[model samples]
Target chain A: MTAVLDRAAPAPTPLRRDRRRWVWGLAAVGLVGWALVASGLFSGPVLNPAGSGQFGRFAAAALRPELDPGFLRVLADSALVTVAYAVLGAGLAVVGGALGALAVARTTWGRRRTGWLVARGVVAVPRGLHEAVWGLLLVNVLGLDPWVGVLAIAIPFAAVTATVFAGILDEVPRAAYTALLAAGAGRTTAALYGLLPLATGRLLSYAFYRLECAVRSAVVLGLIGAGGLGYQLALSFASLRWEQVWTTVYALAALCLLADLGGRTVRHRVAEPRPGAGRDRVLSGAVLAVVALTAWAGWYLALSPATLWSVRAREQLDYVLSAAWPPSTEGPLLREVLGAAVDTVLMSVLAIAFATAGAVALAGVAACPHRAGPARRAVGGVVRAVLLLLRAVPPPVWALVLLFVMLPGILPGALALGVYTLGVLGRLVGEAVEEADRRPRETLLAAGATSAGAWLYGTAPALVGPVLALAAYRWEVAVRDAVLVGLLGAGGIGVVLSAATSSFDWPAVTTVLTAIVALSLCIDLLADRARAALR
Target chain B: MAVGERVAVVGASGAGKSTLLGVLDGTVPPTAGHVEVHGTDPAGLRGRALRRLRARTGTVRQHLDLPGPLRVVHNVNAGRLGSWSAARAAWSLLAPQGTAEVRAALDRVGLADRVHERTDRLSGGQRQRVAVARLLVQRPELVLADEPASALDPALADVVLELLGSLAVAGGGALVAALHDPALALRHCDRVVGLEHGRVVLDAPAASLGVTALEGFYGVSR
Candidate 1:
């Protein structure tokens, strides 16, 4: 084709996809095909109808959870430990994030694009790994120390927090900052006087959001024996005590709800502070509460700095490093890693596609719109709770449970991650719905259009952009979370890594981890490109 | 320009008025000509020296580049950022310092009651007055204002210009403001410098110029 369109040629149809989008669309279709083939769905029977009886028992146990007073007390204690881990982990992440943001921020690098890129690259290594992976590695060194749970969450979350904080800081209008610099403020002081205030609301809101995620990550870490609710769940799950597993799951769900509610309250207050101020009282109270909770969490965990430098810790570290060095480049190991990496990508793509579809379907009912009828409100509340429960029960738990009825395959694993992600994507999509401008819909309705017609013309059009963007963003997260689900022999690099670790093949473990990080980085870049294209 | 003399720089859009102010404030370096602010070339200076020079040269940009989410008091206190220690500057955001002075400055701008309000919540004219209040707290020896009263009505604009003029006179400093209105320029300033296409078209004592003549430099015919 010519670089310039012929003057005589008619314009292309508006509905037609541009070349870039067509290319992306084709690539997407190709990837889906690859995922399906790799899933081996057509090659074999992937059903285990007999296991449904067992799955049924697990489902029924959700209704009559193990409510023995003794078990309840144990759950209560474990729940506190989970809370402590979440609080301390999230709190430390925020602090580390602040420092990391400064290190990586464009404002800090200014014209030094290379330095900024380098900092971002360094951060991606930690950010690419899941909390569970960190927990696994830390377990090798720390061996059941409370620090493992905290650090696992803190490391990856801090990297994420840094990325987000830097974005927030970067997005602040630079006029105020430049004006401060013109007025002779030092770089740090200028940023403080200018950038910080503008970014504070978003930063605080994100911190609260991270706390919510930390609560979930803490539970996930517990699954790998970090000692919390997930540990109890795992213990019961191993013994096939479905009732006790459901009880632990419910307890975990309640903790998640509390964290989500508290975080949402703070985020709202921060977003719209009360008029006048010595400082916002609600915000001050929340900050004070977090500080108190963090202190208590630290004390309760009995975290000692000495543990990090202890002889045994250093020995384990040295041993692991020596064993893991010169990561296995053997032909068989490399080939397996390559295959598993593709499987991980396919699993994530399927999971996100499933989640996006489900989220879009449920988002309308999930969003609690003002002026909605009582019946609508009740459905919305129930949908919201179900979404919460879906997300709260860690992905590994979902993976194991799904394995029972779906047979050992990628489909079950993808569905498990898909189900959990839907919980998150659904709420986000619902919020997008709630925040959408209602004027168009109302006007359409006022014009005597049917409700479905109004929704189609007004709501759906606006929602497509935000929902797609959220789904694309979550695609990156699903890939990382896929590692968690994959650990349970669900057909991903996680499975390979788990085997290597179990066999004490440290070199092979390193190779698998490298593959996971590489896959994640590729997905990260692809997701970014997709977002820009979509935008 | 003599100390305490209020000068108004007038020009069409993109006529280098802001560029000139930028050079004087040391934020923009002149490619050809030398610029000496308070007897030091800001471009030649470095580190502490440059900051000290800038601390004494307060600028009120046309956009009134105050952080919108910040409290009015903190925006006003940002003027003190040049001279205050970083620690003090950071602390002042949480628990404002020198509120008495800030209040007095706000009182002059008729925004005393809005000291605790967010800067963005104010109207355009009010935010402009807040910028003036910032300069008041800064107490710089040299004031540079770019269309500082553009958002205000005639009465408030006069009040704002008068405050700026008096501020310069009180501190034995010079006020060099870029004004869009010739009448205000004549009333508030001693010297008026007019430019077109980055070249100075007219430089005369305010007494030597008339509104109609200044209007010509603005390319206006009525």
Candidate 2:
């Protein structure tokens, strides 16, 4: 009825409708580009002097992963440094996040609206930009020290952690908190004893999950000469030694897989542990791991409060801030910044659109049952491995690598991000597929429904909501990443920010940073609403 | 005082039926009275000892609180979680812990093939049976259930109560259940205990209880 009434009313011009259709078509094309980039089968879009020949060689090198013992040993050292930094960074982030969460929790601090707004603003600044960008900014001040590496991961991570932690804390059963408060317990005590325990497991799991992200960030931070497997990879990539890069990549992948596995084990164990030596053993192992990793990280990085407050460091930071103050509101600057922001937003949408599409297509294959045809099984394994690599390498790394074969445009940056997002979205979509109730599909098949028919009628219904939620989440991430990818010369606000930073144009950098921060928070809020609607 | 004494406790929603069974299984404190199960006073048992007491007495509750995310085999294995060492217990989650025992328990409940399936996908009745299978794996000296059949239809309820009766009777242990239906109690139980407003109003052999007796005990007339 609505469509018929609209058609009968003052109709949109055919030209306007065609333009709308064209925009969707471009998104569809971007989605296709996502697949081509993932599969390494598209080349014309990029002015690749190396092209597919080089891309294929690089892709094949991943298959025949360099297993040289000497180099593998070096890779292992880099891996340790990566894990150590991530553990330390994520640990500190948890502490900082917890305090932020407490400060911002509406339940306890709802009366202080100004404080809450200020806290939120503080959290968004770090979380709105990618960790590598933070790394670059830190390098200018901290310079060649492991503290640079550690703080690079810790700062933005802490910000993201604070936001997520606050959200989780806000969700804890308020009845208990209120009950304790009513019973005359202080608000802080009530929160600690009543609410914190309730949300701690979730907080821990999220922290562990962030460890996986931190590992990725730690490597990307390496691109700015911060120490880790990523630093080593950056060095090797710069020299065009794909073989050594693969070794480092393999090491990095192992670290990620280990972190992922350990995280899952701890989450499950802590979520429900029974009386026995089993729980005791697991708990102790976890404590041992955390203590050892954090200690080693701190010791290795030589983290001290002394250096942070050093006159030189403080003076440099002050100088940078002074230079950037009263963010230039000039009309021309505004136009330039606005244009960059638009490019960033469009790039993110394209990246996320393509990533979700690619993920949806491959999810069926990735989640195929082992009982399926052997050929299908092999294809599934290969696809899953590619996805693992895609996710395992940070988005910035993908952007940097793509820059070699592709033109320095948002397209390459978007493609790189799409590939990275594919790894994440593919797993999410696949898990949703795997977790769906198989009984309906089975019944359909048993009743002589074709496999495709059963999937369409039974499985598809359950997947729609979760896939949408994942897409929303990926979009928020892609937006933040779009700015970061500008570091790789991807056309976006990051380029503007990067150009300004290199030339000591602090005012421009500050303006661009403010814009990026605002854009990301808005995107994040929109995505949060989308997820809330799912509930 | 034979081992398999089929005792039925009848009560309204808040008549302390669950608390009574919980005391016997060492899950709740009596506060005023001492209780014994298999000659062991459970009032003072703590830590491992309390867990052991619980592991020995398989008490099914009205709410089937099985973790739905785990496989049927894992849910069943939860019955013996207290008995297994920590390593075996944790490792069991990775791989099926004692597959034969898990399969046998599932077989008794007619869910042999579903041992590897996630428990949440099962129907309401199937989930209740999975709890029963967990009780079977527990191999308790006494079985205590508080209104386990409240969620099932009449016929399914009868079948489940009868299965519980036999699972207890065959082992020469005891089956004590809190029930809503007076008929199931009179038909399946040897002794019936009815409580009204947290106090026992009637205790008699099920064979001697009639419709009038139950109605009077419940303070209802028909």
Identify the candidate with maximal lDDT: 1
lDDT tens digits by residue: candidate 1, B1-222: 899999999988888898888777765568898988888776676666666677788788877666555568877776776667656765665577998898878877777778887666799999998889988998888889989989998878888888899999999999999999999999999999987777888889999889988888777323
TM-scores for every candidate against the unseen true structure = 0.68, 0.65
Give lDDT tens digits, candidate 1, residues A479-517: 988888887668888999899988989999889888888
Candidate topping DockQ? 2
**Tens digit of lDDT per residue, candidate 2, span A412-504?**
877888999999999889888877877544432322233554454346656766787899888898888888788767788888888888898
lDDT (Cα, tens digit) per residue for candidate 2, span B64-140: 66655556777777666546665665566666567787776666555665766767779888888888887787777
- iRMS for model 2? 23.2
Give Cα distance to truth, residue A17, candidate 2, Å.
Answer: 21
Model 1 in CAPRI terms: which quality? Answer: incorrect
